[model samples]
Target: MKVLITGGAGFIGSHLAIRLLKEGMHPVLIDHLSEELPHARKEYQLKQVFKTGPAAYYNCSFLEREKVSAIMEKEKPHAVVHLGGLAGVIPSLKDPSAYIKTNIDGTNNVLACAAEQNVKHVIFASSSSVYGEQAGVPLSEDMATGRVLSPYAASKAGAEALCHSYRHMYGFQMNILRFFTVYGPWGRPDMAFATFIRKLFHNEPITIYGQGTGRDYTYIDDIVSGILLTLKSKESDVYNLGSGRPVLMSEVVDEIKHHFPNVKLLQKEARIGDVTSTWADVSKARVKLGYDPAVSFKKGFEETVAWAKEHSDLI
Candidate 1:
């Protein structure tokens, strides 16, 4: 099978592409490689994927409807995984228009092109941010997402609605996976885990915001496993691919301190658009997609630190 992934040069997209290649499937990637983002590791991530195997790559934004359509027509992929978008809650607040344009409008283009090509399956990468400030502990898919706290979250929710509409009209299988705080080797530099590691390496102080809030902190491999399971499923639905356990920011900092004992810490008020906590209820995914996240925070962090040290120049 051939699969096309937008944001293929990104951390998650690159990891997914390598996994698909290992499963004897062809993976095609499209990414704008935007320079405006906080990270500049797109080239490094793509090199890692190439090390695993040869895959077709296109450096183009999905916002360009004609280019997206042309790529879809040329590839004729069996599935489309939409993962391209401007990520980060704080950044989204500063430039909500960019988030809306890329996350919502760009998604429309991808969905339209997929429908035009008669693609069989599409997996939309949503976020746990959509369930902002929920009353419940473990967030379930059935819960309402009408109270999102950030433009980034709102954009994902809007894109998700578009996914359903396209599925209803075009009669194609659509799966929306709401990812939690995913972290691991080659993780996004903007994320807390990577940021902390970089600071520690340079003997700089790591900032702790909002009284050390908690996050699901799901591992990259586990997320990829969930994606692969969804790819094989026939049903179209939403699932939360998370660790189902929230780890406090303090605990994460402590874990990093275990490696860098002399790391400095800075405390600051939590910025706006930041959620207090995120916990995932993966019961639906477990029953429907057999999604099981096995890596613990300790083990995952250790592996991530090792990877970062090995490739210190990249981070």
Candidate 2:
């Protein structure tokens, strides 16, 4: 099947592209976020992309509804995995208008085109931040999600609403994949993993925020599995794609220390809109989409460290 992946050249999107090619499916990539990455990362991953050779590529933003529609009409793709948007919770708080434009307005365009072009299925990339600051261990799909702490979370909630509207108003299936702290090779530099690694390499102080906030740090491969399995499903549903193992910020720091023992530390107050903690109840995914996350934090961190060392120039 010909699958259209918006943000297909991104960290998760690039990993997805590689998997799709191996599975013998034609995967078309749209990368408006190429410049969003660190310069070194962009250059390195671009070379890797050209080396593997994707099925097709569109170097334009999905915010352009007319152009997005045109691409949808021309490609006539069987499905769309919408991962295009402004990312990061803290960054969203920095410039909410940009987040609204990219995450909300841009997603509406993608969904509209999918509805108009009769795309068979759409698997959207939503954030667990939509759950907001809940006093709980494992957040479930059936819980209320409107109590978001940041503009980014609010925008994802809005996008999920749009997906529901399109799915009901039209007939195409929609599968909302709520990803939690996905990390691995070729990951975004803004994420904690990259920041800590870069700091370690520089022998700089790595800051830990507010009682060592914990998160369910999932691996890239497991998230890709969730996406692929969800694509194969016909029913419209939501699933949490996470490792299901929540770890404290200290634990993550220790995980890094396993590789870099001399890493310095600094303590700081947690930023506003930062959730107290996050742990996903992936039971729905386990039951429905057969989404099983296999990589533990230690294992995943080791793999990421190896890849980071290889591309230390980017750090």
TM for candidate 2 is: 0.97
| Residue 164 lDDT in candidate 1 | 93
What digit string (tens of lDDT, one per residue) describes model 2 on residues 1-315? 899999876888888877887887888878765467865665565556666755788878998888888998999999999998888989888899988989998999999999999999998999899898985579999774599999999999999999999999998999999999999998899988898898888899898888848998999999998998987887899989998879887788778788999988888888998898899999999998888899988889999999999879875
Candidate 2 minimal-lDDT segment of 10 residues: 38-47
Cα lDDT of candidate 2 equals 0.87
lDDT of 1 by residue, 200-315 (tens): 89999989998748998999999999999999999999999999999988898789789899999999998899888899999999999999999999999999999999988877
Clashing pairs in 2: none
How far off is residue 134 in model 1, in Å?
2.0
TM-score per candidate, in order?
Answer: 0.97, 0.97
- Return the top candidate by TM-score: 1
**Model 1, residue 144: C-alpha shift (Å):** 3.2
